[model samples]
Target: MASSLNGKVALITGAASGIGRATAVKLSKLGCALALTDVVEAGLSETAELCYTEKVIVAQLDVSNAEQCDLVVKETVEYFKRLDHVFNCAGINPTAYPILELPEGYFDKLVAVNLKGTYNVTRSTLSHLKEHADCSFVNVSSILGQRPSKEMAAYCATKYAIIGFSKSMALELGPKGIRVNIVAPGFIDTPTNASVKAGPEAVERSAQSVSLGRLGQAEEVANAVAFLMGDEAKYINGSVVEINGGLAY
Candidate 1:
């Protein structure tokens, strides 16, 4: 609550639920005005309500669409006057299949939403970030980016690309006072993870595989993100912080 993010304006994509929803509330507590976006309008509003920030606004858009990305950024800035931070968290999991079994269409959509979606958000916001002396961005990646797993080749590839893109862009933007970083989370409990955890056999299997005895909470990741985007992490650019409870090992 004492962090310097107070009064800063932020735009977060995929803000309807999960980590995005958690982050919206976290940032609001830090006194940042927010603009939340998601393909789901109703969920976006739900997140806005939790934020409880009078300055909060919501928009519905598919981040993978460049034009929608452009419009969302433009409109968010127009509403907030200036953009100080952004969290590119809009993403989708790849089809759980072997490489040869995956379809080209599925791969394309996954990349568009996961890898290219991150690119689209930052590409659309770069100009605004450059204009602000203290612009900061944290792109959501996954511990999968650090490694791989069977039946998760496509998802791992996309997450790995996000880390690469964040580092490369960080170097380019650092001189301009814009910071870029990646937050790589491990398996976290969510609607998706809940289904995976439902069956007793699968839950037992995952518990054995994960380093942590239990799945992670979205707030845990949101806290780490807060630090990276805050003034405390001004020198932490071009780095990928893993929030996976040592799961990658």
Candidate 2:
């Protein structure tokens, strides 16, 4: 379409903080109304307030819950009467224990919130998204999705699954004029990684690993997402836009 999002509506999960919140604000500035959801109500409300559009709606959503995903999608479509974009930014990042010492349910929990949550939101929005001419679905993955890390098998598995799932959906939905893509981000200074970035040495070590000698910012990832969702990338689909600062690994 190569047009703007002046009258479009976007549904963003994990909109409480980080890339999700940044994406919401970016879309709002581009003239898209927002349906922002997250498990954390406080952060989500703040995001909604920061949005420049008057058509913003905030909802509490635990993306792991499929039923809740359906409800939230229904509410969004009903409130806006149309949904043109989706950002699946709801995910968890935690260092998994070594295979031998891995907790019983740790893997399953990660699967539920990261992989399954992305699937839940995508499937819920498919019905309405198909009806739109220039619809887009963007899922968030991680650089770890392509490059493995020690003691992070569970997290890596979910991210890899998202890339695969999103690409598959892109293939399935492309003929229908609905674009599906993924954003694989490297080390970013988001709240989700507050623990990992707690120590200066840890932060410096991470920066040293990137060719740019610095970690990425949430808005950098959000910018890629906004571009992919907009008409500028109308011909792009089944693609993975990596936001890592040239990580050596």
TM-score of each: 0.94, 0.96
Best by lDDT: 2
Question: Could you give candidate 1's per-residue lDDT for residues 1-249 as a string of tens digits?
Answer: 476899898899889989999999999999999989988778988898898478998999898899999998999888888899999988885457887898888889889999898888888988887444777999988877988878888888999999999999998888888899999887676655632536767666666666777667889989998899898988899999987766636
Candidate 2 residue 190 Cα shift, in angstroms, is: 0.6
lDDT tens readout by residue for model 2, 28-125: 88889999999889998889889988899999999999999999999999999999999999988776589898886988889999999999998888
Q: List the residue pairs that clash in candidate 1.
A: none
RMSD of each: 1.7, 1.6
